[model samples]
Target: MSGIVDLTLTYTNDVAGFSKEASKVLDVDGWNASTLTFYSHCGTHMDAPIHFNVSNQTIDEIPVSNFVGKAWVIDARHVGSKGLIKPEHIHQDIKDKFVAGDGLIFWTGWSKYVNTPKYRDELPRISEALALWCIDKKVKMIGVEPPSVADVNNLDEVTKIHQILLKGVVIIEGLTNIDALQTNCVELIALPLKIESGDGAPARVIAIEKYL
Candidate 1:
């Protein structure tokens, strides 16, 4: 790892409004106070169990330690667009070094498309084998630069992937500027906005490279 790498994006009221129908800003009776509203799965956000199931826990229910820890950066840029970041993409040596609760950040160079639909349309995804690998590895968290680890158009695969990972490890998606970091171990601190009983929330994710 080298210097600090910012994995979150700048949230703006203009980018994409909260939902398709919800108003981003609330207008008072006559006041001009600035107001913005968004869902938990907004820019650079984390996904809680509740985001998938109504009976699941919310954002505030998450443990703080789950969001901060040592992480491994897996460089899979060689596996280009629409590539499946499988367990094979990860080096055997890297897998051997993973601690039980280490964070795993995959750098597929797919984050270059942030605001464009192509970003979501053509994101590199984690195969079932890789998702199961994280679970078996006891991974504390998994962060990615793309919007998600599953194909956006395929809900079945997305649901399968999320359920497997979200059962234990925290899922941080929509990260940007991760290419700035070196390909090595780094200390990650990604704490989301403490929204009470909220399914998810945007987070400020940063990494500090260790000096060996």
Candidate 2:
């Protein structure tokens, strides 16, 4: 198997509420350094329960082990713009194969449109049933290629879905490389920045095939 597949996005000025500036430069400031400013939820990130008031726990409070686990990338490429990813969209093979405590990666191939408005404004959202399904099945984590798991434009939809999922699941968004996986099963390792009381923070997520 190939060593690993990086599933996170590179933060840049193009992303909303994200900025970078040279705080110091070699030869001029005797050191080379830069300052990064971004929203807690910007780019590839993980959401804590407190993000939706599901609990008082922050991203830092979540056990790091919860972010690392066996994962299965369910095919969601057919779930297009403004579409809903229903439970039926998740095939029976994946449902039967992945037991509790395994991460589920929804491969919507949305990352290809990152620079386009459709990436955010018209994302394929996870339906309420699907959110509950993950919780009912006791999934360890659910990663998605979209910036959000629900319609950001719909307050009720986004909040409800997040609240339900955040109650028990680790959510990783803005993933990019799931499409490159040669197999549906993978070992997911996602690590978030340890920001104190952070609602969410950018993460570096990767997939390994050797485990399977």
Candidate 3:
């Protein structure tokens, strides 16, 4: 039998200050509907090359296959708040499981701070060397439990890491529930909304696992 795990954060007004307005109500319009006001990159989202690359390629232009692939979850919980995630953190065991075109997710146990003031301030960042390692491995996509791959306060570093990773892979950020994954290896399916010429878009990400 196979089971699915949802790896997305619930889009809420309290989280990231995304707003929602009731457009139609059951008592007045005989239906219930609301208009969402949030940034395209808010919540769990995917970053297209255009997000950091100069070219015109956007989220809608990326192939669907890039968002779905075999994923390996590397345990990075040891990384402390505001610490750097270095290449050595991966170790040989995790590196052995890496295959070209595989999607990689780092479980840093950082999702616990979501919706808090310290969430952005205390994000653990990926080192440039680690980013290069991923590039060398030809990873298809990279996901993290943090809001970004780099320190949010450091604009220069953020741009550098995004540019490096986006050169050959998609990046998924603001992911949650990664710690709930029962296995290290699973099928990752993270599809973003198709928005024309969009730099990035929020996504509904999940993992599918088969049990013996």
Candidate 4:
């Protein structure tokens, strides 16, 4: 499928002193196994309710079915310089694609800048109106290509947006390959690690396009 897209970043260990052996092979000679550990919130991931709510559900507590579903891709690429996704900024065609319980992936074309200072420091944000719109629309979850839907430097907006959406909706961030999707609707499958009582965990996200 030439239109198929893989929207998760390829992870690697960059920290010098952060490497350790997570596993080892005794039967095989010269074999070593290690996991480059880092924060669960890093890389391509989903934000559980517990991520923002002190008393909310964690990664494992959320149902797996909630993370997998049909999704609509809203192309908000024209507002790139502003870094904000407003409700009105969403096209009517894209808006019409929304259905209750469906996943919503905002295509801002920002995932291309992952790890850059601009991506995290001055990344595009989702306005409160947009968050509320998603909630009102009964969207199952919201996914964005940037690290956070809101700018990390803007603490107030970031926290507010999180609280507004995380109350019942899952949030997925740091998605790559979004620019590769052509379908208005695709089957989105994003599964996070079952970290017991963990607020959030990295996830592997992919989209399967359907054609008539």
Candidate 5:
């Protein structure tokens, strides 16, 4: 492999209710240990079927092999903020490369607005038709740089899209540094914390570029 590229977003205590504090300081004549407290879905995370389907599988129940696979990063930077990523946005060349069980990542250059309000308000979302198209392609997972794959302001639509994808595919959100990847295809390794029966958990995702 050429090298591994980190695709996870840095977690901080910036968001209200999410905090990382020093539980023990070395200067206080004790071992230094920090306590981190945050939502399971915060930062770079993976969503399980239970996130939308309460009766479905949780993150812990998912097979370990599912988190690692061949991934394709589709460039959709031409999509405008608050735009829809339609089926046509994915060209035939990219579609012809799809194989069952492959992981798909959309790069829309939205990670540039990570901490800004625009990140939440103006993210490009996948259209329902495009989402179903992925499902029909039998993809193993779908990832995006945005916080959500659906319209966050539209609860009904959000739920619909989530249900559609979560039926058989994993959903990864809040990814960053996608533009740093040197290739469109790579080995993706995104493993989430094993929270038993938990809905979803933050993940440490990376892309490995194999030279040979």
Candidate 6:
């Protein structure tokens, strides 16, 4: 109950632009291998500042250290469908000590709807106020259970939120399995592919629970 929790969603053919084909078999090619292809922003992924044209720094240009941080797992399961997470929803402890380089996560329990339309169409997202709060607090990254932090349909709303946070905060979306985390705090490790000039990329996100 107190171990690392994998927070990344496994990519599948159901997801857009994701495909896998057996390229070699043990009997045929004397080895086993598959050709995997997926979109850059597929499944669990990180957004770079260049994603919204906030900055020219690509995903690979961002230092690896920025992907790891002391993250606080906020209980966000109460967030309603198509709701906004405002400043008050944040725990006081996180707000009080949310210094730069710290990470924040929303455990919204939305991953259960993966592959369903609800997963993307009716997600709880951070409000513009909350986005500014994250900037003011100078958080290193923000992880969410939904595919995107804002409504994918609302181009203006989604763009505004992403641009605001992507100015500095690393945005990790499509997170899963935070409900299994025993501790509220964790050492978050998110590693993404070093795609040249990539605006975003899939990442292997995990949470190492802090045992007391």
**Best-matching candidate per TM-score:** 2
The lDDT, on a scale of 0 to 1, for candidate 3 is 0.87
Cα shift from native, residue 191, model 3 (Å): 0.6
lDDT assessment of candidate 2 = 0.91
Query: Over 4 Å off in model 2, which ranges?
Result: none
Tens digit per residue, CA lDDT, model 6, 1-212:
44788998988888765788899999989999999997888789999899999989999999998998899888988987998998899889877867778899998999999989899899999999999988988889899999999999999999999999998899999999999888888999999989999999999999988642
**Two-way lDDT contest, 3 vs 5, winner:** 3
Worst 10 residues of 6 by lDDT: 93-102
| Lowest summed lDDT window (length 10), candidate 5 | 10-19
Candidate 4 backbone collisions, by pair: 7-176, 83-124, 83-125
TM-score of each: 0.87, 0.97, 0.96, 0.89, 0.95, 0.96
* Order by lDDT, highest first: 2, 6, 3, 5, 1, 4
Q: After superposition, how far is residue 172 of candidate 1 from its true place, in Å?
A: 0.3
lDDT: worst 10-residue window of model 4: 13-22
- Give the poorly placed runs of model 6, Cα more than 4 Å off: none
TM-score of predicted structure 4? 0.89
Residue by residue across 70-180, what tens digits does model 2's lDDT show?
A: 998889888788999988988899888879999889998899998688888999989999999999999999998888999999999999999999989999989998877
Which candidate would rank higher by lDDT, 2 or 5? 2
The candidate, 2 or 3, that scores higher on lDDT is: 2
Off by over 4 Å in 3: none
> What is the TM-score of candidate 1?
0.87
lDDT of 6 at 11: 82
Return whichever of 1 and 3 wins on lDDT. Answer: 3
lDDT of 1 by residue, 1-212 (tens): 25777787887653454533343434644443444678777678888888777347888888898888999889888877788899988888988888899988898877777778878888898999999999998999899888788887998888889888888889998887777876578888899889988888888999888732
